[model samples]
Target: MEFYSFNKENGKQITKFNSNFVMSRIIQTDEAAHIGCMYLDKNGLVGYHQAVVPQLLLVLNGEGHVRGENDEYVRVQSGDAVFWAKGEWHETKSETGLTAIVIESDGLNPSAFMKLK
Candidate 1:
C-alpha cells in the first residue's frame, strides 16, 4: 500500500487557462505510479506534451476536446473515456462550460508537481 495527498494550491501548479482548481492523489505505486484529479475552466487549454507511459482521461465534469498524436482530435464529455497512448503527443482544449479530471498512473507524483502558492 502507498500513501499520497494533495492540497488546494497543488492543482494551481497545473492549471488550464489560468483557472483555480484542486487536486488529490488517491493512490501511488512504490516505483512510479500515481493518479491525479483536476478541474479546468470553460474554454481552458492544457499544454501539449507526451509521457513515458500511456494514460487515461475520464471526464468527471463538463466537456472538452483533446488533440495530439498524428494530429488526431477527440471530443470528450462527462462520462466519456479517452485513452492516451504512451509517448503520444497530447494537449487539451475546452470550450465554454467545460471541466474535467485526468489520471496519469505513470512516473509522476502529485507532491512533486504541487504548487504550495
Candidate 2:
C-alpha cells in the first residue's frame, strides 16, 4: 500500500527514501516479502522490530552495526551484504551515515515490518 519514505520512528536516525530507506511493495501476503534500500545516519538506531519477509542487507556505503534479537551484532562496511531472517526481532545502529540496499522477497521470506505480532 505505502511506498518508501523517510523513517525516524524506532529510536533511529532519519532514513531517506530511495537513496536510503526504500522498500519495494509486498508481493505476497502468505509469504510476506518486501525489498527496499535504506540509509542510517550517524548515531542512528532502528529499534527492535520484525520483518515481513527474509531480508538481505547490502551495504552500499559507510559503516555501521546491526543488532539481532539474540543481542548479537555484526560489523558492516561498504560492499558487504548480510541476511536477516524474517519474523526475527532485529535492530540497526550506525555510527556514521550509512547507505545500503535491502531486498525482501521470496515466498519463504517475510518482512518484520508486516508481521510485527
Which candidate leads in TM-score?
A: 2
lDDT of 2 by residue, 18-71 (tens): 355534322234555455678688887878788766666656788887877777
Give candidate 2 regions above 4 Å deviation. Answer: 1-33, 107-117
Overall lDDT per candidate, in order of appearance: 0.58, 0.59
> Per-residue lDDT of 8-66 in model 1, one digit per residue for the tens?
42333447788655564322445554457767777678878985575656566777877
Task: Tell me how far candidate 1 lies from the true structure as C-alpha RMSD in angstroms.
Answer: 11.9
**Candidate 1: residue 19 lDDT (0-100):** 62
- In model 1, where do residues sit more than 4 Å from their true spots? 1-32, 106-117
Give Cα distance to truth, residue 83, candidate 1, Å.
Answer: 1.6
